[model samples]
Target: MAFPFFGDDKSTIARLLSTLPQTGRIEWIGQRPVRREPLVAVLEAELKTDSHMLGDHARPKAGGKRQVTLIQHESLTAVSSFLGLDAPLDPGRLRRNLAVSGLNLLALKNRQIRIGEEVILDITGECHPCSRMEEVLGPGGYNAMRGQGGLTAHIAQGGIIRVGDVVRVLESATA
Candidate 1:
Protein backbone atom coordinates (compact mmCIF):
# COMPACT_ATOMS: atom_id res chain seq x y z
CA MET A 1 0.00 0.00 0.00
CA ALA A 2 2.28 2.77 -1.19
CA PHE A 3 0.41 6.03 -1.69
CA PRO A 4 2.85 8.62 -2.98
CA PHE A 5 3.35 11.10 -0.12
CA PHE A 6 2.53 14.77 -0.02
CA GLY A 7 5.54 17.09 -0.56
CA ASP A 8 7.64 14.01 -1.10
CA ASP A 9 7.78 12.87 -4.68
CA LYS A 10 7.27 14.46 -8.08
CA SER A 11 3.54 14.27 -7.43
CA THR A 12 3.79 15.82 -3.99
CA ILE A 13 2.58 19.27 -4.95
CA ALA A 14 -0.11 17.83 -7.12
CA ARG A 15 -1.14 15.47 -4.36
CA LEU A 16 -1.52 18.31 -1.88
CA LEU A 17 -3.53 20.35 -4.35
CA SER A 18 -5.67 17.40 -5.22
CA THR A 19 -8.59 16.51 -2.98
CA LEU A 20 -8.94 12.98 -4.15
CA PRO A 21 -7.70 10.59 -1.56
CA GLN A 22 -4.58 8.73 -2.69
CA THR A 23 -6.12 5.32 -3.13
CA GLY A 24 -3.54 2.60 -3.78
CA ARG A 25 -4.28 0.15 -6.53
CA ILE A 26 -2.35 -3.06 -6.72
CA GLU A 27 -0.42 -3.00 -9.94
CA TRP A 28 1.96 -5.93 -10.44
CA ILE A 29 2.43 -7.99 -7.33
CA GLY A 30 5.64 -10.03 -7.32
CA GLN A 31 6.98 -12.63 -4.92
CA ARG A 32 10.42 -14.13 -4.53
CA PRO A 33 10.48 -17.31 -6.52
CA VAL A 34 13.47 -18.85 -4.76
CA ARG A 35 13.03 -17.23 -1.36
CA ARG A 36 9.28 -17.45 -0.94
CA GLU A 37 9.54 -20.64 1.02
CA PRO A 38 12.23 -19.31 3.32
CA LEU A 39 10.45 -16.04 3.73
CA VAL A 40 7.22 -17.83 4.60
CA ALA A 41 9.01 -20.11 6.99
CA VAL A 42 10.71 -17.15 8.59
CA LEU A 43 7.32 -15.59 9.13
CA GLU A 44 5.32 -18.68 10.01
CA ALA A 45 7.90 -20.87 11.72
CA GLU A 46 9.03 -18.18 14.09
CA LEU A 47 8.96 -19.63 17.59
CA LYS A 48 9.09 -15.98 18.14
CA THR A 49 12.11 -16.19 15.84
CA ASP A 50 12.61 -12.48 15.29
CA SER A 51 14.53 -11.91 12.06
CA HIS A 52 15.54 -8.44 10.96
CA MET A 53 15.09 -8.18 7.23
CA LEU A 54 18.37 -6.52 6.36
CA GLY A 55 20.52 -6.61 3.29
CA ASP A 56 24.04 -8.01 3.47
CA HIS A 57 24.34 -6.52 6.91
CA ALA A 58 21.96 -6.60 9.85
CA ARG A 59 22.42 -2.97 10.88
CA PRO A 60 19.93 -1.01 8.84
CA LYS A 61 16.66 -2.98 8.78
CA ALA A 62 12.99 -2.78 8.00
CA GLY A 63 11.16 -1.65 11.12
CA GLY A 64 8.51 -4.15 12.16
CA LYS A 65 7.19 -5.67 15.33
CA ARG A 66 8.21 -9.18 14.31
CA GLN A 67 9.95 -9.06 10.93
CA VAL A 68 11.45 -5.86 9.68
CA THR A 69 9.78 -5.21 6.36
CA LEU A 70 9.55 -2.16 4.14
CA ILE A 71 6.54 -1.12 2.06
CA GLN A 72 6.98 2.33 0.58
CA HIS A 73 10.69 2.68 0.11
CA GLU A 74 11.50 3.07 -3.55
CA SER A 75 14.69 1.22 -2.88
CA LEU A 76 12.65 -1.87 -2.22
CA THR A 77 14.76 -2.08 0.88
CA ALA A 78 12.81 -5.00 2.15
CA VAL A 79 13.86 -6.96 -0.89
CA SER A 80 17.36 -5.53 -1.08
CA SER A 81 17.73 -5.84 2.65
CA PHE A 82 16.91 -9.50 2.38
CA LEU A 83 19.04 -9.95 -0.72
CA GLY A 84 21.97 -8.14 0.86
CA LEU A 85 22.15 -5.29 -1.61
CA ASP A 86 21.28 -1.63 -1.96
CA ALA A 87 18.63 -0.85 -4.51
CA PRO A 88 15.58 1.22 -5.21
CA LEU A 89 12.02 0.09 -4.49
CA ASP A 90 10.58 0.51 -7.93
CA PRO A 91 7.40 -1.07 -9.27
CA GLY A 92 9.68 -3.17 -11.44
CA ARG A 93 11.14 -5.04 -8.51
CA LEU A 94 11.55 -8.67 -9.47
CA ARG A 95 11.37 -10.38 -6.11
CA ARG A 96 9.08 -7.91 -4.48
CA ASN A 97 6.71 -9.52 -2.03
CA LEU A 98 3.94 -7.56 -3.65
CA ALA A 99 4.35 -5.34 -6.66
CA VAL A 100 1.60 -2.74 -6.93
CA SER A 101 0.96 -0.11 -9.59
CA GLY A 102 -2.44 1.58 -9.26
CA LEU A 103 -4.75 2.72 -6.48
CA ASN A 104 -3.87 5.04 -3.65
CA LEU A 105 -3.18 3.26 -0.39
CA LEU A 106 -4.88 5.99 1.69
CA ALA A 107 -8.21 5.40 0.02
CA LEU A 108 -8.32 2.01 1.64
CA LYS A 109 -9.02 3.49 5.03
CA ASN A 110 -11.54 1.51 7.04
CA ARG A 111 -11.44 -0.99 4.19
CA GLN A 112 -10.38 -4.54 3.71
CA ILE A 113 -7.90 -5.56 0.99
CA ARG A 114 -7.78 -9.16 -0.06
CA ILE A 115 -4.14 -9.60 -1.07
CA GLY A 116 -4.02 -12.55 -3.42
CA GLU A 117 -6.29 -15.36 -2.25
CA GLU A 118 -5.89 -15.72 1.49
CA VAL A 119 -4.44 -12.62 3.15
CA ILE A 120 -7.19 -10.39 4.47
CA LEU A 121 -6.10 -7.04 5.82
CA ASP A 122 -8.01 -4.34 7.63
CA ILE A 123 -6.04 -1.23 6.76
CA THR A 124 -6.31 0.63 10.03
CA GLY A 125 -3.49 3.13 9.69
CA GLU A 126 -0.82 4.47 7.37
CA CYS A 127 2.57 2.81 6.99
CA HIS A 128 5.35 5.34 7.39
CA PRO A 129 8.72 4.50 5.94
CA CYS A 130 11.07 4.06 8.87
CA SER A 131 14.60 5.39 9.46
CA ARG A 132 16.07 2.00 8.76
CA MET A 133 15.03 2.59 5.18
CA GLU A 134 17.39 5.52 5.00
CA GLU A 135 20.09 3.64 6.79
CA VAL A 136 19.98 0.96 4.16
CA LEU A 137 18.73 2.70 1.05
CA GLY A 138 21.09 5.62 1.56
CA PRO A 139 20.26 9.01 3.10
CA GLY A 140 17.00 10.14 1.55
CA GLY A 141 15.43 6.72 1.12
CA TYR A 142 12.97 7.31 3.93
CA ASN A 143 11.97 10.70 2.56
CA ALA A 144 11.27 9.24 -0.84
CA MET A 145 8.84 6.59 0.40
CA ARG A 146 7.14 8.66 3.10
CA GLY A 147 5.06 11.36 1.38
CA GLN A 148 3.59 8.49 -0.57
CA GLY A 149 1.14 7.10 1.96
CA GLY A 150 1.89 3.53 2.84
CA LEU A 151 -0.60 1.23 4.54
CA THR A 152 -0.67 -0.43 7.92
CA ALA A 153 -3.00 -3.10 9.18
CA HIS A 154 -3.40 -6.23 11.23
CA ILE A 155 -3.54 -9.52 9.38
CA ALA A 156 -7.20 -10.21 10.00
CA GLN A 157 -6.81 -13.49 8.14
CA GLY A 158 -3.63 -15.17 6.93
CA GLY A 159 -3.23 -17.60 4.07
CA ILE A 160 -1.24 -18.17 0.94
CA ILE A 161 -0.68 -14.82 -0.79
CA ARG A 162 0.76 -15.73 -4.17
CA VAL A 163 1.42 -13.58 -7.18
CA GLY A 164 -1.17 -13.10 -9.97
CA ASP A 165 -4.05 -13.45 -7.49
CA VAL A 166 -6.67 -10.79 -7.76
CA VAL A 167 -6.49 -8.12 -5.07
CA ARG A 168 -9.89 -6.63 -4.51
CA VAL A 169 -11.01 -4.00 -2.06
CA LEU A 170 -14.15 -5.02 -0.28
CA GLU A 171 -16.48 -2.05 -0.50
CA SER A 172 -17.41 -2.50 3.14
CA ALA A 173 -16.04 -4.28 6.14
CA THR A 174 -17.65 -7.42 7.46
CA ALA A 175 -19.53 -7.02 10.68
Candidate 2:
Protein backbone atom coordinates (compact mmCIF):
# COMPACT_ATOMS: atom_id res chain seq x y z
CA MET A 1 0.00 0.00 0.00
CA ALA A 2 1.18 3.53 -0.75
CA PHE A 3 1.73 5.91 2.10
CA PRO A 4 0.28 9.38 1.68
CA PHE A 5 2.90 11.95 0.87
CA PHE A 6 2.35 15.65 1.54
CA GLY A 7 5.06 17.06 -0.71
CA ASP A 8 7.39 16.13 -3.53
CA ASP A 9 10.37 15.60 -1.24
CA LYS A 10 8.32 13.56 1.19
CA SER A 11 6.90 11.47 -1.61
CA THR A 12 10.37 10.62 -2.87
CA ILE A 13 11.49 9.58 0.57
CA ALA A 14 8.36 7.57 1.14
CA ARG A 15 8.80 5.77 -2.13
CA LEU A 16 12.35 4.94 -1.21
CA LEU A 17 11.29 3.63 2.16
CA SER A 18 8.59 1.47 0.61
CA THR A 19 10.97 -0.13 -1.84
CA LEU A 20 12.78 -2.74 0.24
CA PRO A 21 14.00 -5.33 -2.27
CA GLN A 22 16.60 -6.93 -0.08
CA THR A 23 15.37 -10.21 1.36
CA GLY A 24 16.55 -11.54 4.70
CA ARG A 25 17.24 -15.02 6.02
CA ILE A 26 16.18 -16.36 9.39
CA GLU A 27 19.47 -17.34 10.93
CA TRP A 28 18.14 -18.54 14.25
CA ILE A 29 14.93 -19.37 16.07
CA GLY A 30 14.50 -19.48 19.84
CA GLN A 31 11.55 -20.38 22.01
CA ARG A 32 11.09 -19.68 25.68
CA PRO A 33 9.40 -22.68 27.29
CA VAL A 34 8.77 -20.74 30.51
CA ARG A 35 8.78 -17.18 31.71
CA ARG A 36 12.15 -15.91 32.93
CA GLU A 37 13.84 -18.96 31.46
CA PRO A 38 16.54 -19.03 28.84
CA LEU A 39 15.27 -19.37 25.30
CA VAL A 40 15.87 -22.69 23.59
CA ALA A 41 17.41 -22.50 20.14
CA VAL A 42 15.46 -24.41 17.56
CA LEU A 43 15.65 -25.21 13.87
CA GLU A 44 11.99 -24.54 13.29
CA ALA A 45 8.77 -23.58 15.05
CA GLU A 46 5.05 -23.27 14.39
CA LEU A 47 3.33 -19.88 14.49
CA LYS A 48 -0.23 -19.66 15.75
CA THR A 49 -2.37 -17.03 14.08
CA ASP A 50 -3.01 -14.04 16.35
CA SER A 51 -1.48 -15.98 19.23
CA HIS A 52 2.09 -17.09 19.77
CA MET A 53 4.62 -19.65 18.65
CA LEU A 54 3.32 -23.10 19.49
CA GLY A 55 6.17 -24.06 21.78
CA ASP A 56 6.75 -20.69 23.34
CA HIS A 57 5.53 -19.85 26.79
CA ALA A 58 3.90 -16.60 25.75
CA ARG A 59 0.13 -16.84 25.78
CA PRO A 60 -0.86 -13.41 24.59
CA LYS A 61 -4.53 -13.04 23.78
CA ALA A 62 -5.82 -13.28 20.26
CA GLY A 63 -4.72 -10.36 18.09
CA GLY A 64 -2.08 -9.36 20.57
CA LYS A 65 0.48 -7.09 18.88
CA ARG A 66 3.51 -8.40 20.72
CA GLN A 67 2.97 -12.09 20.15
CA VAL A 68 6.37 -12.50 18.56
CA THR A 69 9.73 -10.80 18.64
CA LEU A 70 12.67 -10.57 16.20
CA ILE A 71 16.16 -9.17 16.27
CA GLN A 72 18.51 -8.31 13.43
CA HIS A 73 21.60 -10.49 13.15
CA GLU A 74 23.76 -7.45 12.59
CA SER A 75 22.46 -5.89 15.76
CA LEU A 76 23.87 -8.90 17.63
CA THR A 77 27.32 -7.93 16.46
CA ALA A 78 26.77 -4.32 17.38
CA VAL A 79 25.63 -5.24 20.85
CA SER A 80 28.67 -7.48 21.27
CA SER A 81 30.93 -4.63 20.25
CA PHE A 82 29.15 -2.32 22.66
CA LEU A 83 29.87 -4.84 25.40
CA GLY A 84 33.47 -5.25 24.32
CA LEU A 85 32.93 -8.95 23.77
CA ASP A 86 35.14 -11.21 21.68
CA ALA A 87 32.15 -13.09 20.21
CA PRO A 88 28.80 -11.98 18.89
CA LEU A 89 26.06 -11.95 21.47
CA ASP A 90 23.92 -15.07 21.38
CA PRO A 91 20.39 -14.63 20.04
CA GLY A 92 19.00 -16.41 23.08
CA ARG A 93 20.61 -13.93 25.43
CA LEU A 94 18.65 -11.16 23.71
CA ARG A 95 15.35 -13.00 24.30
CA ARG A 96 14.08 -12.65 20.75
CA ASN A 97 12.20 -15.36 18.84
CA LEU A 98 13.99 -14.97 15.54
CA ALA A 99 17.33 -13.59 14.45
CA VAL A 100 17.20 -12.30 10.88
CA SER A 101 20.13 -11.39 8.64
CA GLY A 102 20.67 -9.23 5.54
CA LEU A 103 17.80 -6.76 5.96
CA ASN A 104 17.51 -3.69 8.12
CA LEU A 105 14.65 -4.82 10.37
CA LEU A 106 14.14 -1.26 11.69
CA ALA A 107 13.06 -0.36 8.16
CA LEU A 108 10.24 -2.90 8.39
CA LYS A 109 8.17 -1.21 11.06
CA ASN A 110 4.44 -1.04 10.18
CA ARG A 111 4.93 -3.52 7.37
CA GLN A 112 3.83 -7.13 6.91
CA ILE A 113 6.47 -9.69 6.12
CA ARG A 114 6.33 -13.32 5.06
CA ILE A 115 8.76 -15.82 6.48
CA GLY A 116 9.57 -18.86 4.37
CA GLU A 117 6.39 -19.73 2.43
CA GLU A 118 3.48 -19.22 4.79
CA VAL A 119 3.97 -17.38 8.07
CA ILE A 120 3.26 -13.66 7.90
CA LEU A 121 3.92 -11.18 10.67
CA ASP A 122 2.60 -7.65 11.10
CA ILE A 123 5.45 -5.58 12.41
CA THR A 124 3.91 -3.88 15.42
CA GLY A 125 6.58 -1.93 17.24
CA GLU A 126 10.04 -1.87 18.76
CA CYS A 127 10.96 -4.63 21.22
CA HIS A 128 12.63 -2.54 23.83
CA PRO A 129 15.11 -4.19 26.15
CA CYS A 130 13.98 -5.05 29.65
CA SER A 131 15.91 -5.25 32.92
CA ARG A 132 16.51 -8.93 32.21
CA MET A 133 19.20 -7.91 29.78
CA GLU A 134 21.32 -6.77 32.71
CA GLU A 135 21.08 -10.21 34.21
CA VAL A 136 21.70 -12.05 30.96
CA LEU A 137 24.39 -10.01 29.20
CA GLY A 138 26.27 -8.61 32.19
CA PRO A 139 26.38 -5.15 33.80
CA GLY A 140 26.01 -2.87 30.77
CA GLY A 141 23.69 -5.15 28.84
CA TYR A 142 20.61 -3.00 29.26
CA ASN A 143 22.29 0.14 27.98
CA ALA A 144 24.01 -1.75 25.17
CA MET A 145 20.62 -3.01 23.92
CA ARG A 146 18.86 0.34 24.21
CA GLY A 147 18.23 1.02 20.53
CA GLN A 148 19.24 -2.40 19.23
CA GLY A 149 16.59 -4.38 21.06
CA GLY A 150 14.72 -5.30 17.88
CA LEU A 151 11.00 -5.63 17.00
CA THR A 152 7.68 -6.97 18.19
CA ALA A 153 5.08 -8.45 15.85
CA HIS A 154 1.75 -10.22 15.70
CA ILE A 155 1.16 -13.28 13.57
CA ALA A 156 -0.91 -12.28 10.57
CA GLN A 157 -0.87 -15.76 9.09
CA GLY A 158 0.20 -19.06 10.57
CA GLY A 159 2.56 -21.80 9.43
CA ILE A 160 5.90 -23.38 10.19
CA ILE A 161 8.94 -21.13 10.10
CA ARG A 162 12.39 -22.62 9.97
CA VAL A 163 15.89 -21.37 10.30
CA GLY A 164 17.36 -20.54 6.86
CA ASP A 165 13.90 -19.51 5.67
CA VAL A 166 13.72 -16.51 3.38
CA VAL A 167 12.02 -13.38 4.73
CA ARG A 168 10.39 -10.86 2.39
CA VAL A 169 8.23 -7.82 2.90
CA LEU A 170 4.69 -8.54 1.75
CA GLU A 171 3.15 -5.08 2.10
CA SER A 172 3.77 -1.62 3.48
CA ALA A 173 1.35 0.10 5.83
CA THR A 174 -0.91 2.73 4.33
CA ALA A 175 -0.92 6.13 5.88
Candidate whose lDDT is highest: 2
lDDT of 2 by residue, 49-119 (tens): 98999999989999788999999999999999999999998899999999999999999999999999999
Off by over 4 Å in 1: 1-97
> For residues 1-175, what per-residue lDDT tens digits would candidate 1 score against the true structure?
6666633575777444344433333344332324322222122211111232222122222223322221433335554554455664454332223444345556555567676656666655655656655654476556655545355454566555443445567655533
Evaluated at residue 138, the lDDT of candidate 1 is 72
lDDT score of residue 157 within candidate 1: 61
Q: Ten residues in a row with the worst lDDT in model 2? A: 1-10
Candidate 2 lDDT at 175 equals 25
Model 1 per-residue lDDT at 161: 46
